[model samples]
Target: MSKKNRQIVLASRPQGWVQESNFRLVETDVPALKDGEVLVKNIYLSLDPYMRGRMNATKSYASSVEIGQVMVGGTVGKVEASKNPQFREGDAVLGYFGWQEYGISDGKGLQKLPESKDIPLSTYLGVLGMPGLTAWVGLIEICQPKPGETVVVSAASGAVGSVVGQLAKAHDCCVVGIAGGPQKCNYIVQELGFDQAVDHRAGNLQEDLEKATPNGIDIDFENVGGEVMDTILGRLNTFARIALCGMVSQYNETQPAQFRNFGAMIASRVKMQGFLVGDYQHLWPQAQEELTSLLQAGKLKYRESIAHGVENAPKAFIGMLKGENFGKQLVKLSEE
Candidate 1:
């Protein structure tokens, strides 16, 4: 009998919050490889906040996922069978295999990963992959921190935000990370080495952020936008830079975020720029090289919350959006 491939598909567009009923898990036979095609058995599937935006019917930077389409995502997998000269069986590669146990690739958009036991294949989905690049581009390219400058990172305990805070510290800046709970806040400060951490759920965002940035924020790596952003904006020093990476706080909201500190941008002359990782693809190689170096030197720290099966991807994704994840969130579909 042929092996069955378990896959998750979009059943409905989310209304306000994403429910498990929004996704449908279906099974199909593992596909046979055609000429110039490779059979990829997915190992890890990434769950990110940006995916919540794609669930909407209204299109944003990327097109919305149509109902019944395989949910969009990045995956690290192994070549199970290959009929292509460019790829061989057992080769580990990275591709957009989405939320599936297996996928078919034509070798057109697949990136073969270098064999390294030092760095786990899973890190390629987190600190050394898109999230890391997003952090590097947002902080290095957009924020442009200088030594002694105060850099504040919202969602600081998350994959991208954690890297942002660490990179800021490496550049001799006073780094402050804003996360949801005390555990996350403590982890960022005590473990991840952020200079300070503010709990956004403590119901004292304004006062806590004010205390954390006594000198005022010179650079804001804005991730959780809503009130966290408003608090950061209100504390911006003259000519501060704001690297607007994400607004995970409002991704599932039916109503738009109410900005209470827009005037602060005018008063402080802040330079706020929003960026997407796709637009800066050219810089990915540079980000990968530098982040790997940081990791090798023990200067970078990372964590992950892994959901065991592909069937749990939707639940894991929903938890990540709610800030329940510690760092990078991934679904482990199969063993490496």
Candidate 2:
């Protein structure tokens, strides 16, 4: 193990578009592992839309990252040194380790990565990790899709949205995916088995959605909340359910836009609920089993856009906010 650690720290808050100046890469001495603590070398770092909100000092579902602190993130890493009885040196684990080459943990909030011949280590950060868990909780617990029901999902080619669309199909629902470009739209329909897909970037977004879903939408797994949410809200059926997992479109807005049809919730009797994955942590084991089975059976599909090297993490994160990532955006910090 080395005597130093390198990390990306939050340099400042952004008003709209975050730039390179907002982050500063610095090196410092690695803290000695105390009793019951472990030192981990990060292998992969997850770049999520939620991190955008944390960059600002504001009230949100989670705490904001303070200036000069390591940018918060989930990491997959190998234990380099351990005084903890439960974790051994070289064991792979997953936890909220922030943006750094190495992290020191006291064993709390750490989970050992399970050995699976069919799954890659990266899956623990994508389809089999937080993104997958978010989709599972939103669709199964919030939306509760039924066979033959009409389902709509925004950002359908993304990590969470991709899983939501496929899971809806597994439940026999007619799934329609909304994405930004022709390539992603094609991937959703042709590769992921979505019944229909609409390119939200098209000039006639409302028209395309109406055509894709002839019948009213029954379950909406919303990820991008902007005009896409508005279009879907208009097509929602009576008693429709909306799982508000994320609002990637509004995350960068200085002042979030107000929904024009906010009053429609009363008329349609729709159930729109926002949720955090941590709220349903108790069901993780059950979700893991179900999602794993689906993956093993070739029913579940996922995509990943990875950037090599730690210095590229910020660029990859900004790209994800602009919808440039095809799937989960991850940064590979090192091979070990």
TM-scores for candidates 1 onward, in order:
0.98, 0.97
Total clashing pairs in model 1: 0
Evaluate model 1: give its TM-score: 0.98
Per-residue lDDT of candidate 1, residues 70-117 (tens digit): 999999999999999999999999999899999998898899998897
List ranges where model 1 is wrong by over 4 Å: none
lDDT of each: 0.91, 0.90
